[model samples]
Target: MTAPEWIELQLQLPREQCELAEELLLALEASSVTLEDGADQPLLEPAIGERPLWDLVIVKGLFAGDVATAPIEAALAAELPRAPLQQRWVPLDNRDWSQEWKRYFEPIQCGQRLWICPSWMAPPQPDAVNLILDPGLAFGTGSHPTTHLCLRWLEQLPLTGATVIDYGCGSGILGIAALLLGAERVIAVDNDPLALTATADNADNNQIAPERIATYLPEHLPADSGADIVLANILAEPLIQLADTLVALLKPRGQLCLSGLLDSQLEAVTRPYQRAVAFQPPAIEQGWVQIAGTLRG
Candidate 1:
């Protein structure tokens, strides 16, 4: 069967205006909207929870080929009068759009001992602890600094025989990595059903024993048990809000690793946990920071 083509309407505007453009495009019946750096800016490594973009961004909206471009252009002009909108209409060739982005996601090395490789690719370092993963509807492929921060911390920990709770376990990357690194058991928890599915699928792909890894929704987590380590790679706001709950999930003197925070947000995120845990200096990478600490005994 032949694939259906699409018409992509794009506008070059300041980064601040990209969101508005995306919303306008969606209202105009665009099937999807994406933003890219118009100035070809290098985003080597973005801060945890940061959606890094260039000062100038190109907002692209996709629509069925039959949709008229005139209305979209007219709406942009009317709604975003101040935006120096340089618009273009391009025909997006029919192809597997979902898998096309995979080309850009090569194997990523998180730490000295860990490597995250797409299922289709061969491991660059055969001896390393390779994590077979792919970008999916859920996050965490070891490409994001936040995930890398958590993976690096997991690699350094004495996970052998340890029990872990991967709170907010997007893609289940942290929990899976823990299991592969010799953690006896991991309880993966996430509110998103898609995330739970991805984590389970990835765990199966890795041939991890079903008994070694368990998946649960937030409310379904076993209340009677606590873990030797707790890892949460969610944004700073939620990290602060869930500080008590996360701490309660850990055993006394158990370790906690928190990522998905910008360097500037370090103090605010850490403040909520300080009364109960003693944090070590944060691990900073590309403007992102990971906070790891031990609960007070």
Candidate 2:
């Protein structure tokens, strides 16, 4: 089948001019806009206090194939008078948008026993524990190193009949994994409603009981009654801020697994919870760290 083509305008502009450039493109009826480093700088996910972009940025915008470029250039010239700009129009061939991710997101095995299988792919090991998850807008697919750290920790934990709280649960992957590994039930919490919905849908897709996984917004979460295991795979700043809240959700001598932090930020993230959690040496993967330990009474 033939792919649809869009006209993409690539604008090489100073980082400071990106904001005006994006606004101008959007106003010019560009369907979407994206940015890349014009100098070939390697970009990582932005973290607390981290710089996200390069000094020279290539701001690319996509428009309908028939859309005229004259107005776009005119708007750029008028709006960003002082900033130097280089622009080019290119044909952007769009492939099967629906199947694009499948090429990269195949089945992933986190640990010895757990296999994260995409819905369309059969589990490599029928006898092994398999999590049927399809990639979505929500995070966590056993892809990110942070998620891998958390999943591996969960896989190794003694979770049979244990209760778990998946703090900041993205796609419910961590919680669903706990259940698959014999957790009795799970409380999945996230700030985004879309994440909550995805978690619930994924839970159902995994054939977990409707009542086994409870989804809630942070404010809507039940009072912290505590659980045998608490898993939080969120950013370092939030982990530090929510240290007390998360600790309060841990039962006496309960286990806690924390990720979504860099090896550099590990000390700061562990400081708040240090007094309460008897943390073991952190596990590092691809510059990401997982801080896991038992909560003190």
Candidate 3:
């Protein structure tokens, strides 16, 4: 049996009007709607609970193959008369939409010894420690500058036999990478249940022994828990707020790697920890920075 094709309507508009446009598309019975950066701008380190949009957004709507574009155009004109909208349409062939995005995810090598590869692809460097990953509902696929920075940092560290804590574990990539790099044990923590689940699943996928990695909600972390290394790849605000708590999780002389902040935010994020830890220069990539520090006894 042949499946029905779909039509994708795409329009560019000011960022401020994206919500209105999305609502209108839903009202018009679009099966799905997505927004992308129309100008290919970089959006880095959005705060928790904040939905940062690009200056120009491309709003796309998927509709039934037989739907008429005139009605959609008329509806938009009626609802947003002053909106500067340039609309185009493309026909989408019926296929596995779930797997379609996989085409864009490729194996990425971080620093000297690590590779992040999707499950479907073979490791580009056969001798490197490849972290098998798939794009999921949670974040951290190693493609983002922040994750890339963290991965690079991890690759350079002597993780062998170290105890590590991965706060805000996201997809558990950092913790799992530490495990693969010979960390004796890792404690993966996240506030989101889905992220915890993703971390556990990814760890298992990499054949990490159950005893080597422990998944936890932030509240579930033990009071006496301390690690030789701590990794927190969350945003600046929370990073500042949790400064003491993150530092407390580290053993004396342990290293801390903090990412997911803009270059301009380095001072604000580092100020809280400066009294307790000696920081290295920030590692910057595309306006994002990763701060690494060593805890003082």
Candidate 4:
């Protein structure tokens, strides 16, 4: 196993220049170039509705040489006007991260009551509420602040035998947690085929009752069936688009938990929801916000 030498090239450009930057990078034959908002930084203070700002990330495999850098620089010069660009080198080893990061995935206690444990980890003391989970590709390990906030809110709610709709059900963590928290049944929704398959595998791993869980994709969400709780942890843009659908899936007075949004993104994400339900200030962690509210009757 060889150590992986990595380089992260970060550049900030006007939002308007995003496409041009992407086009230029592709012309340079860079792989997996990512676009992000500098505003995504925690504690980033920016004006509301500010546009024309974006961050471009171009990563090159180590063997890529000075020849690559020259072309990339020329491309950037042609596209972006003297903006901020950063390039840094990182040293990494071949030790499998699957095992390295796996150690951090132990049983987590949330809301003074709920316990989320990987199937391979020992359950908390019997008196404590336990929810079994296995890592999946999508998201929500109960470790991220957004998920933790949701778990805490779940403890404070009365979900005894209530049906739930777990949107963007990554790792099936939230849905499985809901069941262990006393939801009668949960319908987990995610568009990723792998996520859906993992959800089923996780449900089986936890020995959830045969009829206790059902999983589906976004396009397949049943129009008429609603739930007592709607839990979604995707980012803001998608959440706003799904606003009407999410509200529609909630029975009158049904509850909703929205997460995976940064503090900077809260206003955009919460606007539509606020029109339908009164919500409290979000639970904040590491600059991410998770909001909970009850749907209007």
Per-residue alpha-carbon lDDT of candidate 1 for residues 1-297, written as tens digits (9 for 90 to 100): 443577788889988888888899999988778888899888875544357888999998888877877877888889985755588888778764434556898998877888999998999999999989987878898987778888988898878999999998889999999998889999999989889999999999999988888889988888886999999999889999999899999898899999988889999999999999999999987788898999998
Return the lDDT, model 4, position 121.
70
What is the lDDT of every predicted structure here?
0.87, 0.87, 0.90, 0.74
Those runs of model 1 whose alpha carbons end farther than 4 Å from true positions after fitting are 1-100
Clashes of each: 0, 0, 0, 2
Q: Of 1 and 4, which scores higher on lDDT?
A: 1
Q: How high is the lDDT of residue 210 in model 2? A: 86
lDDT of model 4, residue 139? 69
TM-score of 3: 0.78
Model 2 lDDT per residue over 220-246, tens place: 888855789999999988999999999
Clashes of 1: 0
C-alpha displacement of 253 in model 2, angstroms?
A: 2.5
Highest lDDT, which number? 3
Best by TM-score: 3
lDDT of 4 by residue, 16-110 (tens): 66666666666766543556555564325432123333344333223232234565666667667555455443443544422444676888899
Report each candidate's C-alpha RMSD, comma-separated, in the order given. Answer: 5.3, 4.2, 4.5, 7.6
lDDT of 4: 0.74
Which window of 10 residues has the lowest lDDT sum in candidate 3?
A: 92-101
